[model samples]
Target chain A: MFVAWRDLRTAKGRFALMGTVIVLVTLLVGLLSGLTAGLARENVSGVTGLPADRLVFAEPPDGRSPSFSDSAVSEGQWRSWARRPGVVDAAPLGVRTTEAAAAPGSGGGTGGGAARVAVAAFGAEPGGRLAPGGLAPGRVVLSARAAEELGVRVGDRVRLGPGTAAVAAVEGDASHAHLPVVWTALQDWRRLPGAPGGATVIALTTGEGFTAAASEAADEALGTTALTVDEALAAIGSYQAENGSLQLMRGFLFAISALVVGAFFTVWTVQRAPEIAVLKALGASTGYLLRDALGQALLVLTAGTLAGTALAAGAGLLIGRSEVPFAVEPATVLVPAAVTVVLGAAGAALSVRRITAVDPLTALGSAR
Target chain B: MTLLLDDVTLTYEDGGGRLTALDRVRLDVPAGTVAAVVGPSGSGKSSLLAVAATLIAPDRGRVVVDGADTAALDRGARSRLRRERVGIVFQQPNLLPSLTAAEQVQLMAHLSGRPPAAARDRARELLAAVGLAGEADRRPHRLSGGQRQRVNIARALMNDPAVLLVDEPTSALDHERGAAVLDLLVGLTRERGTATVLVTHDREHLARADRVLTMRDGRLTGA
Candidate 1:
């Protein structure tokens, strides 16, 4: 690090330029990661938050995959799953996206008229693990965002899809397909207009005896597909496409960061080749020189990445308070920063390996 | 003897056949003596120095520096030998632009795994010896051509090696500066008891050498 530290100090302009580039790239990646996670939470939090091991959806047409908008599990299927060996419990879950408005004369108006909001209505058995407490036939539980949007509180009346129900509670911040979720009774959901004849999907809690083979057999006999909570997230209509696009963008940013660091180090190593040869001739081992160069690169990368991540965290904190759906968690901040530094260092390692090929004899007659 | 080259032969691959760079070269320089080798362009003077410095291995025969046979050493061992027992003064100053004059000298000690504090003191002493005490903190770009060459000399002597290989030390200097540099090299060689091999093109500086030799067509002879 002796020579490396001095080199960094001596070449301030060049290193600072590269450092700024790294900082900006890291910032972009951090923000994008936060946005990706935030948007995903909005798109599938309702499904992911369910306290079930697996979700069983009605099998679609021969070539199609299961979808929440298209799947409908009948009572017979739910009963069969509950009776199957290794299945601890199976509860029917209804999901529908519809408009909810503050009931007339309920004093729930946002400004002058009754407030209307788009919501994902989740129907589950009353008092079940999937439903909020106090849910009943004439009552509903609104997610925090849902309650805020409809200008309603507990005990306030709201009209959902041609029926009216009193708000029993406001719990959780869960959403589905970018719409806040409102929990209601399965019977109430069935009575709504355009409602499916049965539950949209069956939430299942399996015990230790639920092997993959057993689940596969059950799925085959019941004409349904079972998925873990994470896999079920793809069943949501908007999550797969939105998450995939954001992830692809994040992937590109990581690639760009590596390439940019590689390019900078490549030029730097080439420019320092003469010095490397001189050092080698002066009895400095190749290993020593390589360590010095890599140490220098790590220093720059760590400093730049930390700065960028701090900036992103600060920005996300402010943006999260608004309705931008930005998450500021360690996974979104520190993980991206670590990835940037590691990838950048890998790029730099490839560039600095050229040091091994430098001939110390060249320093014999070569002019500076 | 501090440095000995016995019937050393070196060659490089050409398109069809091999080009002989050093042919059956034999030389010896004991400690505390200065041996000057003056040669024309392409006379293999540089090749002779390279063989003695252990930068390149001879195809045939032996090179012994401070009683260690370089032919028996691997690349890593040879590098360690150079770090601990040999010092090379390049034709061009070749001082790293990032380091100050003192740091350049200190790098030699660092390569040998010496403590930084001790290296610093040694570097300071050597810089003062080379008459660059006031300019120790100045970088290569901030120093004059003569000062840079002086720093190069101080750097090579930092480890106090048994063998010192100097190449064209006065090539870029005028008469007065070149004489002063040569004088310093001679005084240091005697004071330190180092086996010195000075390769040069100018014959004017040969008078100060304890012995003078000449190279031509890959052969050495008395000047």
Candidate 2:
């Protein structure tokens, strides 16, 4: 990088402009990545956080995707799944979004008015791990968000359908389809108004001997489809559409970054044609020239990406706690920065190929 | 032992027809001598230097630098020959604007894959030889015209090339600076035993050449 290094030092203005562009693009992509992960968490953390490795839904007719909104697992299917070989445990889990009103003299009474919180309620049977407090019939566990919204604590009664269940505990801040969770018994869940179906889906834990044959037997017996945890994410309708659009936007950002880099280096290569000719005449090989050019690009890209990543991470930390859904995992921040650098280098590589075609003979008279 | 061009004929495609730049031109310069090629505009002086420097292959001629025939060599081989054996001082003082005077000369060593530290002493010596010892750290834009041209000359010889090909080295300088450059070329040719070919249109600097060759209409005379 004899000339490349010196050019970078001497031509600071040009490279600064290019580096600014890279930084801004990386910042935009990184922020979007965080938001995408945060929003996705809100959409599917309920299913993803399940103790079972897989969830079984009532099979739609042939050639259709599984849908949580459309699935309703019956008791016969749950009993059949419990008897299947290689099935360590099968638990019936019901899910419904409904309005719940806290007891009049509970924490809701502090304001002297009823506090009705919208929550996604889950139902499981007695002795099943899905049950809130080990089959205490009238006890319910509320997620932190749900508890906060309803202004109820333990030993307080919250009305579900026609019955009032005592709050057992306020657990982790888990969400389902953008709403907080409220756990109740499966029988009590069925009794809730507007919850016409018995159970939404069946959560399954499979042993090591699990096989396709076992799956087929369970599916036939249960009359439900089986999906890995990852596959079940598509069952959430909003998650699919929202994640798809965010991913598409992220893809477009990557492409645009590449194009912007390509355009900048194309002009830079053209501007450096004379220098290339002189170097060629000075016996600099095509390979050496390319390495020098790409090394210069890597230096600039790495600097710009790191700066952008740090800025984005700081911004995410500031806003993640707020209402905006922004997740700041290593995968969310570092991956996009890495992609930007690789794609930008690839773009610059395409432009620097013009170096090989420069005629050293031109340097004899053209070097002015 | 220096430079030899044997019956070289170079042509170029011009407007769907062949325009001959050098027609069967033969030239030679032994070691420790300077041969200047003077011509009017478009008289193939630059073409002759280009062929001798191995930047262009002649249509029908052999270019022999230090007993190696470049016509039979591959592109890589030709570039290697140029790197190790041939040196060209361009028409313009084509110093990379980013490098200082010493760095410009040291770059020649870097191109040949030599360690930069190993080349530093030699770069300083060459710059001193060209009377640029004090301006070694000055970039091209900061140096005077004469100093930049001298740096250009120092860069060309840093590789210890057997044949030195100079093209219009004094084009951008005044007479005093041009004379100084010409004298430096003549002195370097004598001291280093390099066969030097200096291409120029200026008649005043002809006295520095051991032999002066004039070209007209793509033919050489008055050698």
Candidate 3:
């Protein structure tokens, strides 16, 4: 990288221009990655955070893709799952979105006065691991966001359906389908409008003997789609369409970044043809030239990506502090940056291959 | 003889016909000898250098550098031989713009996979020999035409190649600088005990050559 380093130092303007492009592309990818993860978290964190490894949903009609809105796991199906071999636990988790309002005289609980906020109401067995405070009849555990929206705390009353339930406690900030979750008993959840009488899905904890074949056998018998937590993300209708578009955009960005970097290096190598010929005529091997060129590209890509990543991380931290959903994990930030560098290098490699074809005899000022 | 070109013939395809560049040329340069080849434009001076440097394989016959037959070597071996035993100073200064005068010489060591640190002392000595001691750190653009050409000359010697091939080294320099460059080439050839072949159009530098060969119409004749 000796010549590569000197080249960078001497030709600062050309590399700087290309470096700036890489930085901007990386920044765009980083921000989008964070937003995609954050939005995805808001859409499925409630279901994903469940204690079970799999969520068993009622199979969609006519073999179409399964969806949370369309699934309604009957009580019999969950009981059968609980009795199945290798099934450690099968907990019924009901989910639905409904209006939430503060109770009168209990922490801004004015009926007809306080705003009614839409919330995803999740119901599990009273002592289930998901909604911890034992969801009893006429009582509910409100997620922090749900409680904040309703202006109510513990021991306060919030309206669910026609009747209201006393808030047992404000627990985690679980959400689903972009709405904060309100945890209630199965009985109380039945009263909410548009909620099926049975549970929405059955959360299953499988033993070591569990396998995809066994899961499929059980699903076929019980008329359900048994999917792991990550796989179940596609069951969310909005999540599928929204994430697909964003992901397509991300893919295009990666491709564009690779091509852009490749094109830049192509022109750069062409412009340095004379110098390359001179080096070759002076006994520089093709491999040496390739390494020098690639090293320069790698250095530029790494510097640009790191700077962009740091900037993106700072932006994510700032955004995470606000109400906007933005994830800043390794998968969301570092992965994208790494992919950009790898793809950019691949592009640069393709461009610099032309260096190998340069005729060393050209340096003698004549053609053979 | 360290650099030998035996019955060498090279031709180029042009418009469904072949134009000979070097026609059955035979040359040999023993170590510590300076051989000058003088020719006009298109007179096959560069072609002879190209063949001797192993940049191009002759159509017929062989190039033996440092007693190793280049015809038996592969592409990779040819390049290695060039780096290890052959040095070519291009017609133009052709210094990489990014490198300083000293670094231009150091680049040869880099190409040969020798440590830059190991070559630095030698590079300094060579640069001083070419009168570029103070201008070692100055890049090509900052150096005058003569200085860059001198750097080129110094770079070619850094590898201690057995065969040194110089192509029109002073073509781009003024008469005084050209003469100085020619003198440096002749003096280095003898001091380094290298087999030297200098190709040029200028007749004035013929005095410095141990033997002068005039090339015309794809043939060489002793002068």
Best model number under TM-score: 1
How would you order the candidates by TM-score, starting with the best? 1, 3, 2
Q: Is candidate 1 or candidate 2 better by DockQ?
A: 1
Separate DockQ for every predicted complex: 0.60, 0.54, 0.77
* Candidate 2 structure quality by residue, lDDT tens digits, B1-223: 5788888898888889998899889898999999989988888988888888888898897889999999889888888888888888888888888998999999999888888887999999999999989999999999998888899999999999899999888889998888889989999999999999988889887888889998886788865
Model 1: TM-score, first chain: 0.97
Question: What's the lDDT of the predicted structure labeled candidate 2?
Answer: 0.87
In candidate 1, position B53 carries an lDDT of 81
- Poorly placed runs, candidate 2 (over 4 Å): A61-64, A109-112, A132-135, A212-222, A366-368, B221-223
Q: Which segments of model 1 are wrong by more than 4 Å?
A: A110-113, A366-368
Residue pair clashes in candidate 1? none
Question: Model 3, B1-223: lDDT tens per residue?
Answer: 8988898999998789999999889899999999999888898888898888888998898889999998999888998898888888878878888888888888888777787688888899999998989999998889998888888888888889899998888889999989988888888888889999998788898888999998888898883
Interface RMSD of each: 2.9, 3.0, 1.2
Model 2 chain B worst lDDT run, 10 consecutive residues: B214-223
Q: Residue A275 of model 2: what lDDT?
A: 84
- lDDT assessment of candidate 3: 0.89
lDDT of 1 at B221: 82
Model 2 residue A137 distance off true place after TM-score fit, in angstroms: 2.2
lDDT of 3 by residue, A1-368 (tens): 88889989988999999999999999999999999999988898888888889999998989588888889989999999988888999998888888989877777777579788999888888876655774788899888988888889898888888788998988887889999999898878888888898999999998988888989999999999899899998988888988999999999999999999999999999999998888787777888899989999999999999988888999999999999999999998999999999999999999999999999878878655
